[model samples]
Target: MTAQANTALAAEILEVPHAEAAAVTRDSRPLRLITCGSVDDGKSTLIGRLLWDTKAVKEDQAATLRRDSGSQNDLGLPDFALLLDGLQAEREQGITIDVAYRYFATDRRSFIVADTPGHEQYTRNMATGASTADLAILLVDARAGLLEQTRRHATIASLMGIKQFVLAVNKFDLVAYDRAVFDQISTDFKALALSLGVRQVTAIPMSALKGENVVYSARSVIPWYEGPTLVETLELATLRSGQSTGFRLPVQRVSRPGESFRGYQGTVAGGAVKPGDSVAILPSGQVANVKQIVTFDLVRNAAVAGDAITLVLDRQVDVARGDMIVSLDAQPQTGLAFDAQIVALQPDGIVPGKRYWLKAGSRRQRVQVEPVQQLDLKSGKWQSADMLQMNAIGKVHLSFDETAIFDPYELNRGTGAFILIDPDTNNTVAGGMITAKRTELGGLNAHEGRVILSLPADLAEQLLATELLASRRDEVETRRVTTSAARQLLDDIDG
Candidate 1:
């Protein structure tokens, strides 16, 4: 397909599929990825091999690794996991405990790999890594085939919007390079990926410790198998993009650096914006035109998602930290109630109807979260639940005292995702994504409470005479006020 067609396909992937966010697009930026699987599945070894073969490892670091390992693996190489597992406890326990990020590059591409822990206890860390990744490398032992943890990791990656998956059937050498075993494992993983609604997948069989099929080809020993190496798959992978959604800039802060200059500063979270475009300050629903798009370097005609720029409005408006600046035509949803899915990250789990701080972008507000359903990994189903335990993935109901603005997570990851923090400890307890707004009040729109519409007096009367308006005439309260009064009301609501 053409590059333009590929770009369009990338945009399409970020949209809602099956009420869940599917594979998000990745672009020219460095690919962000995570290594995930069951414990002792060679995740770290795969990464170390990538770094080594790519020549990303320095002599000093390799020397340190050799000394720290005290012994070498059968390949006459220092313990490869040593290159990533840096913690003292991790080295002693021979397992990864925290998420370790490493940067490496090849002639064709650059990569930021998050080596996530394999144990169930550190599942939270894995989620953190998956949040920003464009692809996931799911490792599994060739002998063990697919395990519960393998399923869990794949599920979380899919939920986090990862579209591309690489199944690394590690330790093929230990399995005597069994072609049948590799074929079976790949077949099982393909079914799992298909169930997750992920169609972009490539499975490869290799021994990471022996450095076969990681950075190099595996056809030498496994003569029957023919496929690209692990490095080649990643090199061809894409990075996630936020430009598919309409223009959105979650105001980080109101910048008034000097008495003469004032602007709203923040990174563009979605779409693109330029001067002369009409924009809306949301939650307040105040409209303004983009007077200027300011940057430290110089002014530009346009800025797309991920660009950091200051916006100067033509006239003063009630915009503050947490308020969203978006294109008027493509406004996001504003509501008092929303539905979400979350992964409980703390041991305390999530208590129903408990108020916590919900932070999304630069916006932070108090929210009451109630668990609605918990995911059953074994059966791949969701069951009703009143509360969620640590490492539990569940759906929830969110109640806010004030207006909450969001796009469905599938439409825009930046504005649609959030985190819940424990008030007592200020610890982030859960990572979540918004599913949709709850419209509970009898056909009343989710973006309810108050609305201001301007129309000719005769046209308004003609509208009130309609059947729909006449049916709910008692519920409709009409008032007329000067433009000044309307502005004051909006400001009061914002406050």
Candidate 2:
């Protein structure tokens, strides 16, 4: 096409009426979204275009961007990537290395966008961003199509429980706005999305640099395509609810204003609470009735998820920070062992039987992490793994020194997520989600309180020599037997 034809197409697309966009009337909470793709797939540019088209960028900021970018694209517009790649290292390297969060709003709704790094090494950061997102925008270059990183991001977002997906086939202009290429990529992504049990998928062809089909339509340029713009889809998308599970509030503080007042303070994590409701203090199993719900402004008769309030119980109980206040009828799982999926972030990765600090909600305790399997992103398979290296996603077992509380992540994300902190370095090493409480007998019968160990004689002797064991030698039973005798005993038990 000639330059005049390109200009005409652009004019037609721009002149298309905004009345075609979907209408969203209700006043809903802000929708959280994440942009992810392979390296240089235009994640930053997509966000920048959204901001610029929505007029979220100030004039002085735009001028500074123009000055700093120091060059204009062929479209005579400032480099949109400069708008979001704020870190000095990112600007210098021209690649996103960390998660950048930005906020913008349309006339219909508001949004919080997390632009995550696309490099495979920063996959942990991508997981961190996706954990809280209600929707995911998976961008792919039109020329490159669906790359391995694209599939990896999609899988992580789905596992993190993001049902809404928007496949932005970006840089369509570079491909001469070919509809067949767009359709092929969309069909391929749809198959992937279906495999992940995601039914809400919207695929759009867009040019983030030229601001096509982002906040506006590209109908004139790509006359064969018809769908909601990215912003329109986002505006119509529903917000994920925090009250999907039973009532829960992980105590963050205990407020005692004076002799007359005693309350537990925390943001309501799941479900709702009202006066006269029976509640329990977890890990302690202390039960009480809800007396009142107090906030900064006044006492409320009820409180729901997202509300920050102080709960006053009918009677005094042993409640403290890190303790969970939950509905007595629907108590959260409490056990010493749990199964979780994790993304290893540190260079050393997750070592088998390594003790680390686990923090969930406001609670922190020592835990031993054991890797069960690591995901093969390219093949979409789980392979047995003893240790998870950097950026590896794996399924693991967590054994805690003390009882831990959690709900399945699918039921309640806020109460089901945790982070692992390295004891020696004090750096966060992994993010994890509770899959289930490791139970025996399919949860039909309770677990025995005793632990049986089988070890070599030398190792057993070394373990028994530790100060901890030496102090409690009389507390636990010990036995010594030959391998043949041990085998015979096991055979007898089986018989």
Candidate 3:
């Protein structure tokens, strides 16, 4: 496109009146989302476009950006990427180093978007953004298609429990708006999404540089594509909720004002609780009944997820800080050894047989980390590893001296996730998610010289037809899995 065409497109931006307060009628709480992909795939550019089109960028900042970026592009838009990449290191290197969080809203709803780094070395930083996101916007360059880094970002997002995805095929104008290229990339990514247990996805061709199909529709440019703009999809997406499991309240403290009153105080992490409900104090194996739900305002009858309240038990139990109070029937996993997937964050990678402080929810315990396998993000394979280097994703066995409590990350993200804090420096070394409790011996589950794989029926059939599997057909066993089973298989691959 010529500069004239670019100028015409730049004039279509719809600016919000103000940034501080959004008077738009909201249907729900602000949707927490993240934008991530391969390096130079327009992550920073896409977020800049989102903020620019929404008028979240202040006039003063915009002027500063134009000055700092040296000169405007052909489109007359200051290098939008400079609006993000705020760090001096990032600015010097022309890369995003840290997770830059920004807030913006439209007439329909509010949004909290985290623009994460796309480089392989910053994988840990990307995981930080994904940890709290409800949905993920994975951008792929139209000219480059899907890179290895794109798959890595998608894997991290899926493991972080992001169910919804919006595949932004960015730089479409650079590719001359080729329908075939967009369709091929979209198809490949959808397959990858399915392999990761993610199903809800929408693919749209866009040009972040031209401000097309970001907050504004690209219908005028690409008449064949008639999907909602990026913002529209996010506004209509579902928010993740942690209320699917049983009631869980990791006691933050015991509120004791006087001798007559005693209650366990904490935010409800999962499920619900009310008066007369049967609850159990985990790791101690003591049970009690909820006598009252006490809040600052009044004695409430019930409390659900996100609610902070003090619980008065009918009888005295050994409940204290770090002890979880949960429903009797639906309790989280409690054991001495558990299996988990971790991303090493610090420079001094996670060492095998080293003890670290594992904090999940309000519970903290000393656990030994044994590296079992490392993930090959390119091929989606798990390979044996003894230590995890920085930004490396791996599966490990966690062994605690006493009891540890957790839920599978797929079930409840709040109680299932943990961080490994180095005992020497008190620095966080890794972030992890519990996969399962171990009931067998040894740190790794193996099949000797043979390999076993749980895969989709079609993929499995293709493999069976290959020479490697076809020759050994008598040794293979196949079983049709339910939808839930298929997801579990995908979740088990690396994390």
Top candidate when judged by TM-score against the true structure: 3
TM-score of 3: 0.85
Candidate with the larger lDDT of 1 and 2: 2
lDDT of 2 by residue, 80-185 (tens): 8888898999999999988999999988888999999999888989999999999999999999999999999998998788889999999999999987788788
Ranked by TM-score, top first = 3, 2, 1
Question: Which wins on TM-score, candidate 1 or candidate 2?
Answer: 2
CA lDDT scores, all candidates in order: 0.85, 0.87, 0.85
Error of 1 at 236 (Å): 1.0
Deviation in angstroms for 132 in model 2?
Answer: 1.4
Model 3, span 1-495: residue lDDT tens: 332332233222212222222464576688999999988899898988888999999999988888887754777777889888899999888889999999988888889999999988888999999999999999999999999999999988987778798899999999899888877888898888977767777787899988898988888889876556788777777777778789989999999899899999999989998999999999899999999999998999799988999999999778889999999999999888898989999999999999999998787899999998888878776789999999998989999998999988877888989999999999999999888887645534433444446677788778867533432244467778887987787688759
TM-score for each predicted model, relative to the true structure: 0.83, 0.84, 0.85
Instruction: Give the lowest summed-lDDT range of ten residues in model 1.
Output: 15-24
Q: By how many angstroms RMSD does model 3 differ from the true structure?
A: 8.5
